[model samples]
Target: MEYELIDNTQAKQYEYHIEGVLAKIEYIKTKDKIYLTHTEVPKQLEGKGIASSLVHSVLEDIEKKDLTLIPMCPFVAAYIKRHPDWKKLVLKGINIS
Candidate 1:
């Protein structure tokens, strides 16, 4: 499912708000690559699949824009590991193991 992702570029995060809660994936972008630096989901929202959805949508957006990803955040790296197809979206030197 494609969720609404607000790329708050000024803040350098992609935010998803639902049920009065905010989930975000923070990143750094340089030239053709985006380094996913962190991911946050409110404590109350844990175990509810919010993070997975957020990561999925963010990856989709990154792929659509044809930008390479550097999954600096452990969560994002793990997500890529679980979903191997997305690994192709990652930057060449990254090992999402």
Candidate 2:
């Protein structure tokens, strides 16, 4: 399946889609940080690693723009926790709380 990033400014979020289905993430940007706030994948889209792919794409965008991340979304937090190497991309002194 192919995925595309949609900047849904009206909704204040970035949406990732797979074959027109909202497969993974909804994020917002503020200053130099990208806040991953919500994520949802259809039950059928689960277990196929769509979420991971979406996260990777978002991270790539972050890196390209030299922006940091605030993982407000649980899935993003868990992904970061599981992959400590990516922690450097997180904004310093920024608390999700």
Candidate 3:
């Protein structure tokens, strides 16, 4: 299965659409930080790893832009915890174990 992650800058969200359901990670940006605010996936789409894919793609884009992250969204924070390599992307000021 192919998953395409699209950055909808106007909406300030990274979106993934599959089988007519939309999964997205919402963010708010400052000069140097992108605060990941929320994530939502349809009930039918849960457990398919779509949210993980969305977060990963969004983090990759932020890394490429050289912006740090404030993972305000619980889902995003948990994902980063599970995948420690992604921890490097978090903003230094916000302490996370």
Best model number under TM-score: 1
lDDT tens digits, residues 1-97, model 3?
5588888889998899899988998889989889999999999999987888888888889999999899999999999988889889897767564
lDDT per residue for candidate 2 within 36-60, as digits (tens), equals 8888888877898888777877777
**Model 3: residues with Cα > 4 Å off, grouped in runs:** none
- Tens-digit lDDT track of model 1 for 1-95: 44689999999999998788889999999989999999999999899888999999999899999999989999999988999999999878777
Better of 1 and 3 by TM-score: 1
Looking at candidate 3, the ten consecutive residues that score lowest on lDDT are 88-97
- Residue-pair clashes per candidate: 0, 0, 0
Q: Is candidate 2 or 3 superior in lDDT?
A: 3
2 or 3, greater by TM-score:
3
RMSD of 1: 1.2
Reference-based TM-score of each model: 0.94, 0.78, 0.91
RMSD of each: 1.2, 2.7, 1.2
User: Is candidate 1 or 2 superior in TM-score?
Assistant: 1
Q: In model 1, what is the error at residue 86, expressed in angstroms?
A: 0.3
Q: Give the TM-score of candidate 2.
A: 0.78
